[model samples]
Each structure stands twice: as structure tokens, then as C-alpha cells.
Target chain A: MSKYTLREAMAIHASRQIRNEDKVIVGTGMPLVAAIIAKNCHAKDAVMLMEAGPFDSNPLALPSCVADPRGFVGAPWVADPVQMMGMILQQGRIDLGFLGGAQVDKYGNLNSTCLGTYKNANVRLPGSGGASDIGAMAKRNLIIIAHEARRLVEKVDYLTTPGWMLHPYENGKRVKDRLVHRKELGLWGGPEAVVTTMGIMKFEEETKVMYVSEYYADLGVTLEMIKENTGFAIDTSKADQVIPPTEDELYILRNVADPENIFI
Target chain B: MVSESKNSTKKTKIKTLQEAISQIPDGATILFGGWTVTRKPMAAVFEIIRQGKKDLHLVSNPGGPESDLLIGAGLVGISETNFIGHEVLGIPYCFRRAFEKGGLEKTGYLHDDWTVQTGALRILAGAMGIPFIPTKSLKGTEIIDPEHDLLADLRGKSKKLPNKKVEFIQDPFWDEGELLLIPAIKPDYCIIHVPMVGEEGTVRIHGGLFMDFYGALAAKKTIVTTEQITSEDYLKKQPDLNSIPAEFISDIVEVPYGGHPTAVQGMYDLDFEFFNRMVDSTKKEDTYVQWLQEWIKDLPDHDAYLEKLGVKKIFSLRADPGLGYNPRLKRKS
Candidate 1:
């Protein structure tokens, strides 16, 4: 297998999180790319929901946005945004939600609201569209973000989406604990994985603090590089080198999922 | 109860696009109907720019060309947006530029459930004459956080409006539960482009009804532009197809290819090349002004705008009847 772009690797890694029966609520860009790839390959029966109110849409081409005209093609049920989010999502019917953020903390908390202050931001990002809802309610959520020191911060400026609120330190080392559940906060679900350009990261089941799971070895991305780019201390003790994308996966993604190579 | 007038007494007010849009007073709160580049009321938005309307407050859930053009023209004062982007084409360059430059004032909410859905719920509440609607999505997020002053700052800048931007309350019945309540929004006017509008004011929207259905109801008045304005009898044949009732609409204009640059599902495809050009032109300040001069200022009206787009480009975007999208359009992988 040859080397792949980080975007392609991220999409491929993100697709691995989808299961055959998972009802996925997808956002735009790479999440759509990853979902299409998963649908065409492993998670063929996965129910996909678009925020613009379509269920089980089978478009010939990838939809550019949630409400892209293509999303309406051969859709099983077309609903209003309220019905999709308020009725379906808020009801906790969605199983998986794929989201992205401008910044993510060690606890997997996301910040897409603003850079400095909400009112006066040094760099005002496009705020969470449905990320908060998805992050708060999807039974399991996957986040896709580029690897950078500032992006993977120790603490986010604002908690746009709840990650793990309980981060207790013992002897300056994180302890294994689940202090607050989404259910406790009147929200459901939480971050499951963080797929980045370099590798995949997951939270310690008990601690809910993110740790490197698999580093992409084929791309020559080292654990040291990952640590250097991360704002917080990341545990790579049990991390393994990820196998490169198989030829079959690359062929399917390039030819079928992202024929436009929009994300790749 | 006074018996509602049932006769053809319901007037189908017809106005030129300019005249219809001129009714939107300066600084009036407005809402636009469309998602992304599809079905955006480009012709009417262009008219607003040409008329030099100023200090307008736009409430678009997930906006596109309409809001972008308004901000670019400096006509908008405050904008409540969830996602102001061109989708695959990328974020709205002018909007981002204006926003970052402080040339535009803005507030955003979560799109997944809070932003667009909340907007829809707000509109539904407004249509039903409700004070506010309870939502569970914005809770546990910064949107409901009192410390977040993104919206509060803008509220201070604007004139005294009737409704509070957002409010939080502990659920009276539930022991440990709370909810976010967004006040109902009734826009002074809402302009939307549709595939067809009946001569009697019925609107037939192709593809997903999206927020257009609610936006029409949530506004005090609705102005509709369509690819074709068929006879009232034609629309009456298929009552199920009618999305917006005649009574809610104030005026209807027949404007072919009015959703150009954007799309009119089953009629044409999004002009990707045009979007690319807009993105490129808006990358720099001087070039954006030049692009605007060529497209908006120079072109007198919708006809002129279409004429400037040229027959070849327009024909290329035309969707095949069976496919509902341009068959000739190709995306490079």
C-alpha cells in the first residue's frame, strides 16, 4: 500500500467507527465522505440522517451539504429540520454522530464557538451547527480534526459541547474515573474517538480522557510528533502502529465515496 | 367568530421584484428561505442590494447567497446565522471576511439541532401566535451560557426589540432538568424562491420543503419568485403538492432562472464555476468590489443578470427532466 493524504487517512479511520446497524447523524465535508465510504463498504445498512430532514437518502453523487439537492434523491422520508433534530435526535434515537471542531481538549471537550471570548474573539470560528446536539445526544460520537498543538488544547476556551466534565488528577497523573455521565447532565452520549490526520485517539473508558490508540506508521508520523503537536500530555504507552489503508479501501473511497476527491 | 372570507376575494398582489422588496423597511428584521445554494432568492436579494437598503437584521438559520450578498452590499446590520456557507464550494467568503473585519455584526447557534431546528420551532411558535417554545438542545452548551456575550453585545448595539434573544429556565415538573427557550420570531417579510407559484399565490416547492415552509408562515408577508406561475386551476388539481397557502403570500413574480448561481432543483444545477469565481474574487477586498461591480452594480435586474451569465453557461446548468440535476455536470475526483 502507498502513502495517503492525512485527510484521506482521517476519513478512512473515521469510517472504521461506523457499524452495520448504527443510525448515523452526519455533518458536512469529511464526515459525509467517511459515511459514504462506510455505507459503500462495511456499514451498508447503517441509517444515515441529514440535519436538513432526510432519512436514508441514496444520492448518486456525494451531497455537498446537509440540504444539498442531491440528498433529496430517492429519500425514504423527507422531514423538516425540527422533526429531524427535535423529534428524532433529541429523543435519543440516533446511534452515531460524526462531528468536527475548531478545538478539542484532553477530556475531548470541543470548542467551535470562538477563539478568545464569545463577544470579542481574536478569531471567531463558525459556531457549532448541530455539533452540540450531536455531541450531547448521539449514543456514540466521533470527532475528526487536524492534528496541531493549539487545536488539541489542554482546555478549550468555551465548552461548546460537553466531553468528560470529571477530570481528576492523582499524583499529577489522570485517574481512571467517569465522574459525570451525559445522562446526569440531561444530555446523552459523548465523544468516542478522535480521528486526526496522524492517528486515532480514544478516551480511557473510565477516565474519559483522550489517549493515542493507534499511530499511522506508514505515514512516518511518530508518537513524538503526535505528542509535540498536542497541547496536553497524551498517553501513548499502549499505542500501536496503524496498518495502512488497504488497496480495496482506497479504490472504493477514491472511485465511489469521493469521486470528486473533495476531501482527499 | 367572523366567517373567514372564502371567495376569490383573496387578492393575488403582483409586484416587480424591486417594488416587492422595497416594502422591507430599513432596519426591519427579515428572514430568508433556503438551504445552502439551492432555492435561494438571489434575484430578490440582488434587488435589495441595488435599492441600497441598510441596517437590516437578517435571521437565516443556515444561510447562503442571500445573506452573503446582503452583507457584501453593506445592507445588513445584524445577522443571526447558524451556518453561512456555500457548502462544497466552501464558507461564505464575503461573510467571513466581513465578520472577521468587524464590518458585519453576527451571532451563531448550533446547527445539528439548535440553530436551524430552533429557528423552525420559533417560526412554528410565531405562526401559532405563541410567546416561546421550549427546546432541550441548546442546554449544556455555551449558547445558553449567560457568560457567552456574542449575542448580548449585538443586542445592545441594535434597537430595542420586542423579544429576548434566549432565556433559560429550570423545568418546573422535572426535578433536575432545564430547557432553553428561544423567543418566537415573526419577520416583517420573508422572500423565497420556489420551482412554481400558482397565479393565486400557492407555492409548489420541489425537493425538500426545508425551512421555506415554516419561513413563509413565520413572516408577516411573503414574496415569492418562481420559474413558472401556472394558473390557479393547474395548482388546484394537485392540492398535496401545495406547500404555502395563497393567503400567506402577498406577491408573486414569475422570474425564470431566478435561482441562478444557486439552483432550482429539477431545473438547474449549482453553478460551481460561478461559486469558484465568487470565492476567488472575494479573497481580496478590491477584487470583491470589482466582482460585485460586474455582477450586481452593472447588471440592472434579474434579466440583465441572467443575460450576463450568458446562454451557454445557463444552458450548461439546466438539469435534465429525468435526473433532477445537470447530467452534463461533472466533478473531478
Candidate 2:
């Protein structure tokens, strides 16, 4: 790859998270771009779903929002929110879910509620639509966020999505010497990986603590730059330079995925 | 789902937009049916603001202009929603300013937030005529924390307000950790905008029925505004295509282009430029005030509002017959 925007890099890495046959639920913005790229470029059999109740939607053009009528163009059928949120998602069938929030912690917990207080909010944000539902119900979730010191906080202002917050349980007993885990609280799957504008971060196997896993060196986003900008201490010992997007990935991504230059 | 209109001799009522909205008094808890620029009853919303109903409670699902515009108008006292923002247009500036500039304590505005699935389950419970619904969502998150319950003050104060925020219980049957028992919410009215409605109250929603059907079924009364009103025989021929029975609807308003700025499928595309303009106006308090007055307050009715939008813009937004959305519409992204 000669050069790519930060968003394109994020999209490429985020697209890699999807498997061929994964039943994916994607929120709007870059995640939608990422899902489209994955469907066309890699995850051919993946089903693209959204909160506005479209299941297995295959759109020809980019929808302005998840519930935009355009997304229903090539779908099997349109559904109500009850069928989507209750029958499908709450039933725990979706495999891979994507979410984005205003702020996130090392535990992958997000806060999309408000900046200050709930009642007397300093800045009221759009609250967790399906971020919590997808986080708790989906088998695995991928979080995409902008990397900044204030946003990459030690603890989010409000916990909208349950992340690795408690220890895992063995036969209904909490395991000792372990960081927070979602399984202990009955959440289906927690954050698997966090793809940021800077790089990709993943949680440790045992501790569930987030650590830098990849970085974009060509964009001058080094491991040190990421660490310095982080609000909390982050591990970068096992970090590696990210493999640039392939020619095929780039072509499909630009032409098919986001022809409008929406996210990228 | 049981309803008062069930097996009743009374036919479903039909009224003008103003008259339908006029029946709803101040302080009524309402659920506006729409999500992210789709199927919002813009005509009813405008009328409510124009009528200046005060201290209203709102139930929302990933709200777009329906929720944000109401909050901007400063009519809503409490808004329970998972999300409130114009998706492509940007942040809900009015909603932000309402809370950020005017704190809940100071401004008398409370925001009770819910996760999307949990919100749906709550509404579903209402539609089912159940008091509460069980859910695995909001388990380990602060959404269910008692301290974050913004409506604590309103708890037990009014019939509409539930006594408790949420009751966490372990699965007694299978013993699968804690399950959140979310309270049911049957709003005073559910205003749903759709493409077609039968004379006897058969609703045919052309697009994604984002909680609108459940909302219609659950509410004490439902007002369905439509782009066109068809005959009962026309809808009954394809009963599967219709959304709900005649008993569920309280009234019908034949408001063409009622879901403007956020129209419906097979009828019109969302007015993205209008959303963009509204979002832009919200940046400044004065501009927002001016914009609201110009578009909502100053306008005599939905017809006038449509007139101000101009015939050219209206025709431009009409969805292509084959496609459910306007193909020629140029998007920002």
C-alpha cells in the first residue's frame, strides 16, 4: 500500500476481525464501512445486520443510517425492532458484533451516556443504543474508537457496555488472581479486540487486561506514541507493526465498500 | 395482546392532526415511534410543540429528530431512550445543550437511559400486558446501577413512574446468574407514522417497523398518521401486510408527508439536508430558537410546514417506485 488514511487503516483492520460465515451486527459510521469491506473482500458469507431491524441485509449503496430504507433494498425482509432485539439478539445467536462509543477504558468498557453527571450532565451523549446488548449478547464484539488521552480513560464515566470487569468462574466459583471477565456476570462475550485510529489492542488471555497488539508504522503511529497518548498504562512489549492492506482489500474497500468516501 | 377496542362496537376514530394531538393533555407520557430517521410522526411532533404541551415524558428507541426535536423544544421533562442523535447530521446539539448547559437539577430534565435490547424488552413486556420483562443485558454495566437512575425522584410520585429502577434476580429455573427484570412502559399514547392505513384502522407500515407496532399495541391509545388512507377491503385482502388490527388504533390522521426530514420507505427518503440544517442551527442557541420558530412554532400546521419546504424539495425526496429510497439523492457521505 502506498498510503492510506487513518480511517481506511482502521477499516482494514476492523474488517479482518470478521470470519467468512460470521453473523455480524454492525453499528453505523466506520463499522458499517468495515462490515461492507469484510462482506465483499473477505467474509463472503457473513450476514450484515443492524439495530433498525434489518437482518442479513445486503445493500448496494451505503446507508446514511442503520435503519435507512436503502439498506433494506436487497435484504430478504424488513423486521421490527422487537424481532431483531428480542428474538434474534437477546436469544444470543449473533456471532460477531461491532460497536463504537464516546469513551472507553482498558477493560474495553464504554461510556456513551453523558460526560459529567446523568441528571446534571456536562455534555449529554447519545446513550447506548445496542452497544450494551451487542456487548453482552453477541458471541464476540469488536470496538472501534478514536484514541485520545481523555477518551482512553482509566475508568469510563459510565459503563454502557460490560467488558472484562470481573474474574471468570469455574463451576459457579470466581477464579482468583484474575482481572474482570464478562463470563462471571453471564454476559455472552466481551470485547475481543479494539481497533483504534492509532492501532489495534487486544486483551490478555488470563488477566483480560488490554495490551497493544499492533501499530501502523507507516502512518508514524508507533507503539511509544500510542502509549504516551493513553490515559492509563498500556502494555506494548508484544506489539508488532501491522501488515498493510493488500491491493485487493484496498480496491474493494475504496470502490465497493465506501465509494462515497464516507468514513475513509 | 388485549385492548379496550377489542370486540367493541365503536369504529376506530378519525380526526385531523391538530385534533388528534389536542386530545393528549399536558404531562402525558408518550412513545414516538421511529429510530434514526425513519417513521417518526413529524406532524404530531410539530403539533405537540406548537400546542406547547408541558412536562411530557418520552419513551424512545435510538431516537433521531423525533426525540431530539422534542427535547430541543423544551417540552419534555424526562426522556427515556437508548440513544438520541441525528446519525449522519451529527450530534444532537439541542439534546446536548438541554443537559450540558441546563443541568437536570436546574433545568428539571431527567434522562433515564436503557440499552437497545433492554428497551425493546421493556416495551415488549408492555405490549404483552406484562408488568416486567427479564433480560441479560445491562447486567454488569452502570446502566442498571441504582445511583444512575435519573428518575429516582419520580419513582412512585406518579402512576406513570415505576417504584423501582430495576430488580435483579438470579434465574430460579436454570440458575444462570442474575437477570435484570426491567419494568414495563405503556405510554399514554404512541404516535406512529406510516405509509398506509385502512379505513377501519389496519396499518400497513412499508418500512422497518422499529418498535412502532409494539408501541401501538402497548400504548393506552395510538394515533397513526399516514401518507395515504386506503380502504379496509384493500388491506384485508393482504392481511399479512398489515401491522395491527382496528382495535389497537385510537385515531387516524391523513397527513401526507407526515414523516418529513425522516420519511418512510416506499414513500420518501429522509431529508438529510434538512437534518443537516437542523443540526447546524442547533450549534447556537439563538439560531436553534430562530430555526424552531421558523419551521415548527411559526408554521400554522403540517400543511404550511410542507408548503415552506417547497414543492421542488418534496418531489426530490420522493422514493423511486422500484427502490424504497431516492436513488438520485446526493448524500454527504
> Considering every candidate listed, which one attains the maximal TM-score?
2
Consecutive 10-residue window with the lowest summed lDDT within model 1 chain A: A167-176
Superposed by TM-score, candidate 1 places the C-alpha of residue B103 at a distance from the truth, in angstroms, of 4.9
Candidate with the greatest lDDT versus the true structure? 2
Query: How high is the DockQ of candidate 2?
Result: 0.57
lDDT of each: 0.77, 0.84
Fnat of each candidate: 0.43, 0.78
Cα distance off (Å), candidate 1, residue A117: 3.1
TM-score of each: 0.91, 0.95
Per-residue lDDT for B1-333 in model 2, tens only?
666653378655778998999999899989988886788888899899899998899987767787877887789888888888887678888788777756565677888888788788888889999999888777767777666677887798968888887887779999887877889988999998999998778899876888988898889999999999988878989899888887799999999999998868999988878878888888877898899899988989999999999999999999987879997887773
lDDT of 1: 0.77
Error of 2 at A12 (Å): 1.1
